[model samples]
Target: MSSATNSQLAIRTRSWMFTPATRPDRFANAAKSQVDVLIVDLEDAVQPDEKAAARGNVRTLLDAADNTALPPLAIRINSLLTRFGLDDLIMLLDAKHAPQFVLLPKIESPEQVLQIDTLLTAAGKTTWLVPMIESARGLSVVEPIAQSCSRVAALMFGAADYASDVKAQPEALALQLARCGVAAACAQAGVLAIDAPCFALHDAERLHADLTFAAANGFEAKAAIHPSHIESINTTFTPSAERVTWAKRVVEAAEKGAGTVDGRMVDEAIAREARRVLAAA
Candidate 1:
């Protein structure tokens, strides 16, 4: 891909924040927040009785479009098996504006991704997709799901629901294998891997540690339930000034034919990493 395209995708999802479609006022508030992506959730955030109203509200917000003042918009539609899923797609089909992305929850197979892709194609929409891997079946076939459709920009690891599905604790440590699996799949597919939220909203220390671990394990971005967490998540995923400096030095040394940098052996792989860091920075 071209440098411009790579840069666009890199900066597209550093801090993804979700706002309920039922609360249209919050959409404007979230748009102005520090989040890089704003997702208007029509799924779990809305109650059963409010599903229809939430869809209408989201459509109204889309009709009065303003991409300049808003972050990249996405909508988390309900699962295909759910009663509200078809309705969500129908609404999007007739929308005056299209979201930059659409997040599909509880994805289990490539066929599911293909189905959405087909529908969007038929509707003449070019929205990208972010598939949520939140179940054992979904985790097991994440690689296929990531590679299923060309429009998949990222694969999101949904921890809480995955934990419930597997009857495990919602802690990161407990879900380490699943998280790493997702990261590896996205990497192999050359797409982004988004980490799940740290549900302990009050525990800043835990959140920091979780985000750090996620970045170390290969997640490109993280989702946040509250705006308070956006700053930290964005900061954590971004290369720090010190790290950027070191990467530049390493690249310089490698170009000079030096095999060592700060006492560590430098090779083609390490040099490539340095270049990636600078590009991302």
Candidate 2:
């Protein structure tokens, strides 16, 4: 997918699925899975020996017009601190195929975003960015990082790494503040905040609880570890039928000026929320 296509998808994305760049065959499957965003990981998911191979696979996958029919696609590069990162940038920047988004892992400051934005500009690419906040330092400066560059379309939370950094168990409640912090920063920057994936893919109850908690805490989307988790995440993040109905009612009443719905007042703010619910639905 091109960056233009990615820009549209970023506005209302809910389910973000990560597929390893090492497995190009899975790319088509991930695209067909109806995920809002499909990310090809070249970072933690790819080993040192496989980095070069994964980069080639990602380049070939992107170059194919047949692959462009997929959903909004992204490439998660290795950290700038590593040797592979510069090579990843050089190859991707010169590629004929354009990826809509570039996922930057372990982002710690706004300057890092600015530097990347500059390079992409120099290369004459319109690729957007998704900064991964994986540590305490990243969480602290997340707001600035989100606002650092216009190229940034979303902010992703890395729960496992963050949990380790804070010396806490990677539990829903354990990372509550961190999750909330990332969401609040995203809100401040007017960008999407995506929740981290639940490591235990088999725990359906925990997954549901995690989604519910993320939604309540203001995250607009969640990352999925496995393909099976996409549908549940999408359903959980989407506004319900009842919510859409209420939203319509609120909007209709607001159209008639000040009014009440079920003994409660319906004002501009309520109407706005209703509109948002309808949009999400």
Candidate 3:
């Protein structure tokens, strides 16, 4: 799809569920889930010996998926530096149907995004990109990376990998800086910023808490490792009635050329933000 077309169909992508690309049987079930995005993961999720089989399985699944109305489909390829990444790209080029996006894992610089963008262009594919920031280096260069690719639709935090990289607690304040950096970078580039998946599947309460924190910190969506977490992620990202009302009021004031709202001066910038909130809802 063209970049404009991709943007128009972009769901806020509240919850993205990762399904192992090696398992074709699970594709149908994943497509029927409530998750905003279904990510066919070829990295970490698949064994090294199964790479070839996984690629073939993903291709078959995508072929069959053409007739189904699915949540936005994405595939998380292994890092471009890996042998699996090259194989995955070659296989994707031969597929009858391409995924809506390719999630690049362990992205650490703008050069990587540009390199992939060049590769995609040369292959005559319009599949958009979503970079997964997993290291401190990735977070540091996120802004340039986001701006480096016109086809980039979002920046996703790879929290599990990031925590491991930095040797810090996942839910602690130490990681807040990196998270905020990613969110700010995405916002500056006018692309969606998705929070990392909460790994604690059994602890729904903690997941909810983490989702809340992510939302407050400017994440528009999150990744989910399981179907059970999709509902809560969706709920957390959705705008509340009060928030919607305020956004509406802000828009109304802007329509009337009013420059103030509730005793505070409002401008085109604030009005634009309000409209974004309403549109997201």
Winner by lDDT: 1
- Candidate-wise lDDT, in order: 0.86, 0.85, 0.83
Candidate 3 per-residue lDDT, tens place, 14-56, comes to 7789999887677778766788889999998999999889988
lDDT of 2 by residue, 1-281 (tens): 13222235545488888899998778878866789889899998999999999999988876777765677788999998789998898878888877878999999999998898898988888888999999999988988998888888889999988988889987646589999999998878777889999887898998888889999988888998798889998898788888888889999999999889888799888897787677677
Q: Give the true-structure RMSD of model 3.
A: 2.1
**What TM-score goes with each of the models?**
0.92, 0.92, 0.93
Query: Cα deviation of 259 in candidate 2 (Å)?
Result: 1.6
Alpha-carbon error at 78 in model 3, in Å? Answer: 0.8
Prediction 3 TM-score vs. true:
0.93
**Each model's number of backbone clashes?**
0, 0, 0
Give the residue spans of candidate 3 off by over 4 A.
1-7, 262-264
- Clashing pairs in model 3, backbone N/Cα/C closer than 3 A: none
Q: After superposition, how far is residue 79 of candidate 1 from its true place, in Å?
A: 0.7
Q: Look at candidate 3 and tell me the lDDT of residue 265.
A: 70
